[model samples]
Target: MTDPTPGRALPLEGVLVVACEQAVAAPLATRHLADLGARVIKVERTGRGDFARDYDTVVHGLSSHFVWLNRSKESVSADLKDPDQLARVRDLIAGADVFVQNFAPGAAERLGLGADDLRRDHPGLIHCSISGYGSTGPYRDAKAYDLLIQAEAGLVSVTGTEDHPAKAGIPAADIGAGMYAFSGILAALYDRERTGEGTTFEVSLFDALSEWMGFPLQYAAGSGHAPVRAGTSHPAIAPYGAFAAGDGVEVVFGIQNEREWERFCEVVLDDPGVATDERFASGSARVENRPALHGAIDAVLAGLTGDELVERLERAGVANARRRTLDEVLTHPQHEQRGRFVEVDSSAGPVRTLLPPITFDDGRTPRMGPIPDVGPGV
Candidate 1:
């Protein structure tokens, strides 16, 4: 890997990561490591490479998913079943500080890339495995796609409207697993630095997303029923969702306390009496009578244009936002003003991407290296 600019080293500058990663989860973790300047060598299948590379050709004829997750890494294409190819991958990992993989449950063991075997030889190598369920659950062998894991982990149960429960537009389960793996690897690296011994850990999509479902899970266990699925709205909070203005533009806002609610009624609704009405007085009362409360809100909002309503909410000191489409988000003023977008090289061409979220106070930027094209077998 090329050296970072002198005197502006990234956090993982000297770290080396070898990743036998295919889809979203493992790729995301290694990509983050790459962002921090770790030299990530991604191992892929010989012919088609990562299957996600074919998910959709939306980004300059490159798969959007692959472009989103595989930036700043070197890819080595090899058929692991071949002795020489597998030996080459083993050699790469033998010198790596970190090794990550997300093969099918038993596939890694069959290929002799299992954590036990690798750790036995490289005692100081941090090994991470990501999977759909876990290594030893009844569902371990089950097919665990992102949507299936979302449904299984109760995320889909609490998402969308009551009549039409829906999975999140993004792959939440996969992302959750990826983030956990990323964090786990970081922690293990820290531990290795202190103790001179590496760590082996596993993260599963089902477990990761299940941890993310803490609120709804606890609510169900405590209240004896699942929270209602209210699309773009909260089940327990009032005045907390999208409302259309006279011009048909949607404005989303929320009231967090009695003070905000009173201000919202007086300024935005232009009716202070609505805040004291018995049907909508307290938080519980408003939630219980949400239909009536929304009706009253709609009546007032219908008389105001989107700009007028937003101005009123601002005057009332209530937090609010305009509902934006995907294209609008790409050019959002906040992102532009903050200089959050950057162009990176890819096989197709240069593509615009957002800078990594973590920022250094000293103005040091994360590595924004080129996306890799699959290379010939080692």
Candidate 2:
């Protein structure tokens, strides 16, 4: 019998993608494609498959990262080094609208599946190449992981507490590169419909993250100095970031302009005179006296429980939030109210997850189906 509630399909139906890939960058790009209704065939090495499969066994014996990124893909094992297998891979591309890969530099060319090689014949194909650095650069061949790129991109230097610089908890560089690849492929597909000519696209983690560094780059350019690492705190803004509340729950808030500062003094802190204090009069002044200002705000906030204080901040028009643990976030009321949970099949079993951030007019949310094993019929 059918369940009481039927499942919704993702948005990319009818599109076919042959992803000759591995790791987070490629799989993340293809997973989104699958989410949007594309038929994504993940081509893995014949024996071992994506190395990520062995990244962990936390999720009932599957890598949580792989599970998160590889859902809904159809696993297809084919050795690119094997001539017959490579021919089969090409056959897949011949029938597919898009081909994606993050193979090492010159690796794709050796296999005769490089973007240039594919474009010569499959003029209508949208070929996307994802890489660590880029096709051509001094660091083109330099190895890149999320942490390494963070340092190379100068992200790590400006992240974390002043005592220690740390990498991002997530693979932001990889995700950024994958997103660019996905969009490039989409734009290429759109272009082929008009010009009937295939286009090759390339995304480098360095460039991808460089775009993300725009703000800090501009900041440094204008100030003639890079921002100092502040951990979870906003580098420029004062009285922002986390602070402990009375109930032992931490709440976060920031003071912006004189208006907000005055309001903060009059309302939440209930010390109207503090706004006129020379130290707290302006944003820069407050930043200059951050330790004292933060101490004052912390003292006031610590007198109230997490919820009560959040209410106070909300009433005063200050942005505030309850620090939520991962477990708490999974059942957050806003997501539940918006009906974001979705069920998808997996090799291990069925699993549920949240929908993408984007919403559409058709009242349909993108679906993440099942997680596929590294090898077919495994």
Candidate 3:
């Protein structure tokens, strides 16, 4: 196996990606390509560049989102409305393996950078478009921010507590769409290798997020009842939520089947009779009697410290985890031990980000490359 380090050739070392991307979704798609060693030329507005650059100044005067997504990219200033600069961007796309954009519904066509326009000129170029909704839907022209897509896709409906709906802390809609775009581009590239021709594809934030809402959607459709918002608890599963110990340390646990239920009763509760109790005999029974079940479990857990409870749960072969805050997760021991974090150079300074989740055959990570200035290609 080849060494999967910075000095060694990466999978996409020879590929070129030209991206006319501003916000999270399209930038995330191209960023993954850059992570695999593709040469990504990011085309931005002439002056202030990607508006996301102004989202915040949390990272030593740079936006954290921009720093996280724009690494290993060469940024070029462009004015699509100006013919000269538009031609420059076109020149970049002419030599690219992939061209990606997330312009509004009809903006690409107006700028002569639409998929059909580019593919007709360069038949071998893979073109991808990301938008709020799809091209043909009534909501196609509607603006779709991350939270807006989450609500429209039914994610907000199922998320958070029973009394209130909440969007995810992270940009789930943007992430879902970006991942779809990334995978779609990979599939298209593989096909192009065989056909010696490229194709065009589209990913919408609404579509991608809706696709991810599959399990809830299927459940609601089949049962004719929407899942109740259970906060930290599972809507369908029993004994699968956060519970606090005597010392107030919260631990989340789950009981999947009869065997696990029996073991949880005997090992964690120290009362095997509780398993066969009529109200808790089966998974459905336990869910129905969740109040009593929680009372019983809480009674047992209240006597033990969180660490002791976790140890006992491990011995019982129960799936469990300590409830951690975002800060705790940031400095999580597993991530640190696994060497999952790496420092990359940014316009502001060095910033740390997680390495791509996949590991190469050589058991090494990708090169953590630098973020670009507003006009690196100037």
Candidate 4:
């Protein structure tokens, strides 16, 4: 691995990560590591590499999913079924500071790349295994795609409208597992520094998403009922969610407290007495009579343009935002003002991408390396 320039080193500058990854979860984890300056060597199949590379051709003939997840990483093509290729991968892992894999259940062991076997030989290696259900459990070998995991973890049950439950627009389960794996690997690295020994860990999409469903799960457990699936609206809050103006522009806002609620009625609704109405007096009362409350708000808002509604909300100190489309979000003023967007070289060409969410106080930027084409085995 090349050394980072002096006095501008990233957090994981010297770390070497060898990842046998595909699809979203493992790629995302390694990509984050690569962003922080880890030397990530991604192992892929000899021919097509990652299947996600064929998910779509929206980004200059490259898959949007692949481009979004894989940056600042090196790719190596290998047929793991071949003994020589498998041996080379094992050798690479033997020298790596961290080894990450998301192989199907028992696949790693079959290839002699299992955490137990590798860690036995290299105690200083951080071994992380990301899977669908986990190494154990009845669902261990079950096919665990993003939607499947979302359904199994009850995310779909709580998402979308009451009439039609929906998976999240994004791959929530895959992202959750990827982030957890990334963090778990970071923690293990730190632990190694303190104890002089590396660690073994596992992160499953099911567990990650189940942890994410903590609030709804606890709510159901304590209240003896699941929260209602209100599309883009809160089940327990009234006057929350999207509202259309006279010009048909959508605005989303939420009233978090009685003060805000009162202000919303007086300034935005232009009716102070509405705040004291029996159906809307208390939070619970408003939620209980949400339909009537929405009707009241809609009646007042129907006459106002989107700009007028936004102005009133601002005057009332009500937290609000436009229900922006994906294209609008790409040109959002916040991102533009913050200089979040950047260009990176890819196999297709220079592609536009947002900087990683993390910002260093010292002004050291994360690595923005090229997206590699699948190359011969390392």
Candidate 5:
């Protein structure tokens, strides 16, 4: 079906982005630019195209990752090793407002696609480089995939249960880097508007993830102890985890302050006395006495059905959510009500995707254009 909402004067309508990217980070960055109505020309390897296209055949014969990240952009094929094809890509970037790449460390420079190399000829072009690690230090050349960066950035250390360290279910490092690169490009674009000069910036998966690991790092530094993994529970708060209702459905909630705790006790548990108990009076005390606190809360919750528990939580002003599976989330009421799903054409066929999270004051959503066919501009 044709998009019901189309052409509402997007802000980045005149911007152009040329990307030499594969996998997650760089593609994700340019995808956002494309969503905002920028023209993004994604240059992939010849014949094979982006390897992510083969990550899986889950989306109408297209890889889920490729379908997710490559929308609203044109795909071209280039053999960077070939001088003629490399020159063609260079010519494309010379006229582009933004250039993004996530080649392995030193690989861009070897291909003469490095920021410094390009900026020498196209001084007004914004160049963004995304890598596993920044272009410096011993770890610069280290193979940095999402899992490796998660481990190296100390994210895995604070994730999962204490017994078993686990990487995030999603590519957190790659997403973080992508978001930063996206913002950096926007910033560069804004600055160019004022100064009429393009700028260069770099985003590393390790650095991006390290910024996100600040909470655990600061907690460890201040207390001279690392935060322990608490499985589904909050390490610093009591009764702030998943609890099963009488129907065996899980409801996750957190108590941020004593006022909320008192409200939760009186309204949800129907026992105001639990809030005044010396052992669980304060947030710190409740955390220190988490075992007994959870036992008490679960005792009350065990008598209520999931719907009844959630209704009570809503009435009591408690922040709570149901533990939903991925499939459940696809049919989530919020998404359905907000009309978050949109369909875009792909090489395989049409596919449904979520609209971009941002909504302009004018009520115009980002234009999610089509996924391109490989070598469309070869």
Candidate 6:
């Protein structure tokens, strides 16, 4: 939709945000708002700025994660511990439509940036706090990281092979908290328009990840046991995983229901009778005999190349995909077909990034601006 405000202003053009944030979750959330046209002013500690900027020197001598999350933001250095800095923040917060802070519980409050204190001064300012844990409860003060949250939330327990659990390759918990914080800010912004009153929003890494664990939690509670850690395999379905092809490539495939099972047995496995075999007759039964069923399908796939097997599976109305590495995915045909890539500028120079997944009727693409530097720009 064309922004009703005109002049091609982004969705949040006139909004002013002040973020007292560091690290991944909060910065990522505020950065996205900046991308959508908010004037984001990131408040950082004087001298070194966000510590995440020095977490690594991998992306053209910059922290890869920092550059990716802190783009399109202006930086202002202020020591929250100092009276002058605190006063300056109050001044900034007074004018801000939204104020974000990801400091630990009590930290923002100690510095007088707590949502309650700030809201009293600026009744219409939306205050958001992103923390490792919420303000209350026993574990609220516990140090939490993405991997730690994943483990605490039981994601690790079901992710890897049966013998050993592994953390997800990406920072799922951090990303989840960030996304929630971003959406929470948006909701608060909308509410302010109607009520003429601002609200406080809080997102914790542990809480965000815990909500995501509901499926496995319910399954374990109902089943009277934990879900099996079937690496690259589904817990509730059979013959749903990757298999080796004759050309030494791997292809992942899935079967959702009885219809797909029938199609697989008849076309892919070339054995219609296998569909009605007592041990593999139903979804639950197939899951019980997954080993035998997988072996049967593997034997057939062993004779066909990965490309040929995928083509045949698609023609038979089965879902199948080839597993590609990050490098391979960069130049994948689907990216060009879907126009998913766009060029973005950074201190390191220009880089290509995947565009936002959403498409518009007017086809006006969002901007891919530069990642800013420390000291002066976030």
lDDT of 4 by residue, 288-353 (tens): 999999999999889999999999999999999999999999999999999999888986889999
Among residues 3 or more apart in sequence or in different chains, the pairs in candidate 4 whose N, CA or C atoms overlap within 3 Å are none
In model 5, where do residues sit more than 4 Å from their true spots? 1-8
For 1-378, candidate 1 gives per-residue lDDT tens digits of: 334556889889899999999889999999999999899999999888999999998999998889889888998998999998899999999999999999999899999999999999999999899999999979999999999999999999999998999999999999999999999999998999899999999999999999999999999999999999999889889978999999998999989999999999998888899999999999999999999999999998899999999999999999999999999999999999999989999878898998889978876778888888886787
lDDT of 5 by residue, 1-378 (tens): 233246556888889999999999999999998888899999998887999989999898889999999898988998888898899999999889999998888898999988889999998999999999899999988998899999999989988997998889999999999999999999999999999899999999999999999999999999999898988888898878899998899999998888899999999999999999999999899989988998898899899999999999999999999999999999999999988887998868889999887777766668688888787545
Name the 10 consecutive residues with the lowest summed lDDT in model 4: 1-10
- TM-score of candidate 3 relative to the true fold: 0.96
Counted clashes in each candidate structure:
0, 8, 0, 0, 0, 0
**All candidates' TM-scores?**
0.98, 0.94, 0.96, 0.98, 0.96, 0.95
How well is each residue in 1-378 modelled by candidate 6, as lDDT tens digits?
Answer: 113234456678899999989989999889878767788888888888899989999877888788778767888888777787689778988899999998889988888888788989889989998888788999899999898899888999989988989999989899999999999999999998999999987999988988989999999999999899998899998888878898988998889999998998888878899999998999999899888888778888899998889888987899888888888898999998987887666778776677665455564555456766765522
Better of 1 and 4 by lDDT: 4
TM-score for model 6?
0.95
lDDT (C-alpha) at residue 123 in model 6: 91
Off by over 4 Å in 3: 1-8, 376-378
Q: Cα RMSDs of all predictions?
A: 1.3, 2.7, 2.0, 1.5, 1.7, 2.3
User: Candidate 2: which pairs clash?
Assistant: 11-36, 12-36, 12-37, 13-37, 123-198, 160-231, 161-231, 345-370
Model 2 lDDT-worst window of ten: 1-10
Best by lDDT: 4
Residue-by-residue lDDT tens digits, candidate 3, 28-80: 99999988878899999988999999999998898989988888888999778
Cα miss at 13, model 4 (Å)? 0.6
